[model samples]
Target: MIAETVTAFNERWWNNFLESTNVLKKTNVFHNCMQKQETASMREDVMKIIRLIAINNIPEFGFRLYIEGKNIASKELSSFFENFTPGNDEKFEEWSERAFGDKKFGIIINRGEKFNPTLVEKIAKKITPLTEKVGIPRLGVTFTIFIGNYGWTPLGIHTDGLGENVMHFHLGKGGKTMYTWDVETYEKIVEPANRFNNTKIEEILDKANVFDFEDGDIYFMPYGEYHVGKSDELSIGLTLWFNNHTESALAKKLIDSLLFNNLEESYEILPMDTSPYYDFENFEDVKKLFHNNFGDKNFLTLLESTYRDYKMALYSNAGFWEPPFPKAEKIDHNLNFKIKIKEPFKIIYYSDSDSLLNLFIRGKKISLINNSSIIDLIKKLNSGEQLQKETVFNTLDISWNLDIKKYVLDIFFENHIIIVDYA
Candidate 1:
């Protein structure tokens, strides 16, 4: 049943919707494109995730709660969870209702993709054509989950981060209305300080672009638009953010990466010298230090190489900002098993120099000595075909050590780039 819905989304609805709307150029809504059953399934999956988060007490997952238009303090949330008991979904729902009374409340969880693999898989499949139309953003993609009966968005009417656009999937028990204003129009009416968190919604309603949608609908908004949403009844939404970085930002990231890779951590502190005068004689020594540390490559060359590495990792993960956590258990390579690449993920490889083959899988880079046999094996694995363990083993160069071959295979299994079935 899920497969049928996915097929419809990928083949028909998405294609037609894209043709009808200028996706990144304007704001648009598609209604009833998804089935209610699918939304229910998504709700169940998200509820399970919320339950797990409460059970484990994971504050780092970026959970924000608000009641009656006020943010809930972290310390209070910690105390609430400390005394709370996690049980079935119904228990959690009842507890929340009682704890917050009848007041409107909202829950926003960042990094939604990390918690729900099923949701991520469906989203990836649906967005494949979009990515084909507009290449993946250099900053990659991320998602945030919004669940609540909040009357108005906590942040009020505001623009997203620079170069960041959003696509919201509404999984609803109730309807939602979105209000948007162009930059010029909003600035003319609202004060500079009131540009964000503006509560004068009634004043701007007449001039705003209003979009009201129900369950199983999607809303896409381009970057730099001032917008906010209102949901008087309980609802859930997943917003996918396509983050595009400015050139300067991308350069800074590359520089940071280069520094991280080249510099060593030091805890030792250097005491201040008695003399206040600058030491001009040591300037050459500082230059020599950086020259030796960064190797013989020119600074520009190093930056270019870092950028390439970033691109490879981003593309390998299908533009996701972060890859799934690697599996914890050590793989048993000796056991016979059929292995296949995971769905919606592809292994990307390139040869920068003649002597080395770079393989990017699940956003990590692995380098092996360039060899035709190994290259052939990568192509076979990437073809999405299931192959016997022995066939994979035989594809490796016979001259290579057996341990080396096994180690290469283990990397794929550990990173979940490939799934193995013992049966």
Candidate 2:
């Protein structure tokens, strides 16, 4: 039998996980500030290139995609699409020939070097504060992209079964298909015992779901959910998949703590693999193992408590939103912008006399905030108005020298702290 009542299991598995993990940090705040700061200076059309990485739980579908029509229908990509198919079938070539018939490559920049330098500059400007605020090793965002033309819709309802998290962002119309199971139900469905063992395609497809997704909308489906996608249009989208082992060290530590605290006859060690262990047939045995290992009262207790703590961590983190602001050359602070932290702590201050800001982390002097005018610039930036050098200089009560104004604004432009609009 399952360890708890459906209600109890639901409490432990799905809702709790969702409530706990979705959070945006000061870095996120700073990212927003930076994005706003540069919005005016960057080319108008280029700003749409911004993609948020947090919405999806799956690492595979984590990053955003900005594709143009020409690139989607390009010869090189078309050839690649033709040469490769999702299921390694001949149909890929057949589909590829039709999709690429006459279309020329559009200007598509998949970030990094391939993207226009100006566009990159604008993005980097916005992205910097968030990265710095979050204390992530690097400010650059990374996610996978799978852009191909699947002309026909094939209904082979399959679960990723990889035991890793994934998020699907469907670009074209055929519609998504699935019967989303809540975590407990999902876990049970994919459990060693009830896995659609040797089920026929027709049988599984009957239980599948179909849904719609437009250009910017995103969906968050956590790990272990069974679903599929079919597109009637010339379909293209990005699927973010994380190979197992992406969970936080805190999560693992919590899990270990629970295991150690619970369990009747203490097992000597915990065995973990980055790959899914159960296959098609040995599920029952695996379920037996899970119950034997996890169903113990001690294990359950630890699971419950650690899950709560992790959930709390996520919930707390979610509430912390900091957008990156453009830094100004003037307005020095009593304490230096550069910080050195020996241990984790919160960095709290004021955006102004009335507004409060905070940054949380474990180490000291992670980096320097540097440019002094960033706070005032963020205030003006958040106003969502044009930020001319004169306007900034006047607001900060600084000397109206053109050379100084140009220098400060130049730094802002170079750092993507402010956006420029040519038109």
Task: Give one digit per residue, the lDDT tens place, for model 2 in 1-423.
Answer: 776633211233334334433522100000111122232333222222222111112113222221322223233443443443223232322433443443321122232112223433333332344334433321113222333333222223335434334433333322333343333544444545545332333444444444455432234454555554434344334333333433464467667756544434534454444445654454433444343546645755757655554333322222111222332344332222221111111222232223332212111111223334545554555455564444566654254455564554454343333445432
lDDT of 1 by residue, 263-301 (tens): 666555545555457756544434543535477888999
Q: Which ten residues in a row have the lowest lDDT in candidate 2?
A: 25-34
RMSD of each: 4.0, 18.2
**Candidate 1 Cα lDDT to native:** 0.80
Query: Roughly what TM-score does model 1 have, to 2 decimal places?
Result: 0.86
- Listed per model in order, the count of residue pairs whose N, CA or C atoms clash below 3 Å is 0, 43
lDDT of the structure predicted as candidate 2: 0.35
Listed in order, each prediction's TM-score against the native is 0.86, 0.36
What's the C-alpha lDDT at position 410 in model 1? 85
lDDT scores in order: 0.80, 0.35
